[model samples]
Target chain A: MANVSNETRPLSPHLQVYRLPLNAKLSILHRITGVALAFAAILIVWYFLALATGPEYFETASAVLTSWFGILVFTLSTVALWLHFANGVRHLVWDTGSHLGQKASNRSAMIGLAFMVVMTIITLWIAIGG
Target chain B: MRFLTDRKRVEGLGSAKQGTGHFWEQRLSAIALLFLVPLFVLPFAYNLGDGYEEVRAAYAHPVNAVIAIAFFVTVSLHFFQGVQVVIEDYVHGRLGMILIIAMRLLSTLFALIGAYAVIRISLGA
Candidate 1:
């Protein structure tokens, strides 16, 4: 308490100073995926609208979505979707006052990441193979 | 309104009195989407490589149309609230207020357009 003063203090160590914990990393990923999903929502809405508009518009939208680049973007988005979703469930659990400990939180994060990868692969296979 | 002690008045009650409402909405939407998303994605995945007419026909089913509409509404609401929390956390002052407004409008627009599209296909219009 003696050293405390009114002078401007330097900022504490931040992103550059420390490696984030697993849960923290996953939390950041959740925010990122949420943002990505917002953009994906626009594309999805547009797809539906094109279908309503006419066959020509539908075909155009479909063509773009089925292209290689489109497929890549979609694949990533799907992965993000699953990751965000799984992490969301973890959040809901925490909200209910369960799984609040560091061990449980970290475990949940790994599980969510695993779920994301497995689901993405399965969905992609089904989609591409159909 | 006159019976409460100061501690009782001040302890648990939030200033806005609406935080629980927001929390419940987010959780309820999350629960709905947990099931609906998988259901929605299955048919969507099946129709991935299909042509325009086929895809439209798939969505033309009454059941498909209804689920799609539900998915759109719930997702838009959930997305709006979720992003609003993020904005409130990281942004401040005039910018945050503006963003919250923009997000609300955007989500509403997407929901409206999505519902219209689903209805159009379902009715074979």
Candidate 2:
């Protein structure tokens, strides 16, 4: 390691320095879905705890969920769920030591996105229709 | 024995004995959740009549009750394993490790209680 200026510390292929490729984008979305899962799980816990407490508590949660803000959170969480679930299947495929090639990987990513849209539409249809 | 010492030399992280059980159980639970998640989500999405009696009736089904318990138990077990790994990476001290262990144990207990509540409510006991 030679003495190098602080600004030139051998760039480690940062995202800002280069365009994000498809595989890279999928990896980023995988991490984001994980964080989203945690947040959604917490909201679930709050709902269950409310249910356990009593009717009044449950009603409060029910009202909040029916509110616009709550609906938005639910919609976002629904999208996150579909995205994560589709990508998770891709991960399961990789776990079995298949689909490591570039073409297969890109195709899987595209399929995952398409599946996410379909699931989101179905989710919203049921959400709004009922 | 000489064989024992040789094995020890090669195996640095001594086997904990229960980790694989935890892993397999978590996986099994996740598979079960594939069905359970949809079952739960559909009812909510439909905005079905959600009176206490209706809720109780839905949960009281043997299939629903059993799956609900399994879902919570497996979810907590998986979360504990994941969070423990995170703590091992970042905590890096005896006290920190102990704190993490305590938190994990507490979380498991909370999950147990929640599961118990679900069972009781479903049974109307």
DockQ of 2: 0.37
Q: lDDT by residue for model 2 over A1-130, one digit each (tens)? A: 4655677567777766788888888777765665556565555555555666676887776677767877788889888878867776787677678997999999999999999899889988997886
Q: TM-score for each prediction?
A: 0.90, 0.75
lDDT of 1 by residue, B1-125 (tens): 59988867666467556537788888999999998888887678778768888989989999999999999999999999899999999999899999999999989988999999999999989
What is model 1's C-alpha RMSD? 3.5
Q: Tens digits of per-residue lDDT for model 1 on A7-117? A: 688866687788888887888998889888877678777888999999899888888788886787788889998998899999999999999998899888889889989
Q: In model 2, which runs have C-alpha deviations exceeding 4 angstroms?
A: A1-12, B1-30, B47-49, B83-110
- Could you tell me which residue pairs clash in candidate 1? none
> lDDT score, residue B33, model 2?
58
What fraction of the true interface contacts does model 1 reproduce?
A: 0.79
Candidate 2 structure quality by residue, lDDT tens digits, B8-87: 66553435545355555645655665676677666557652255555656666787677667666665665565556556
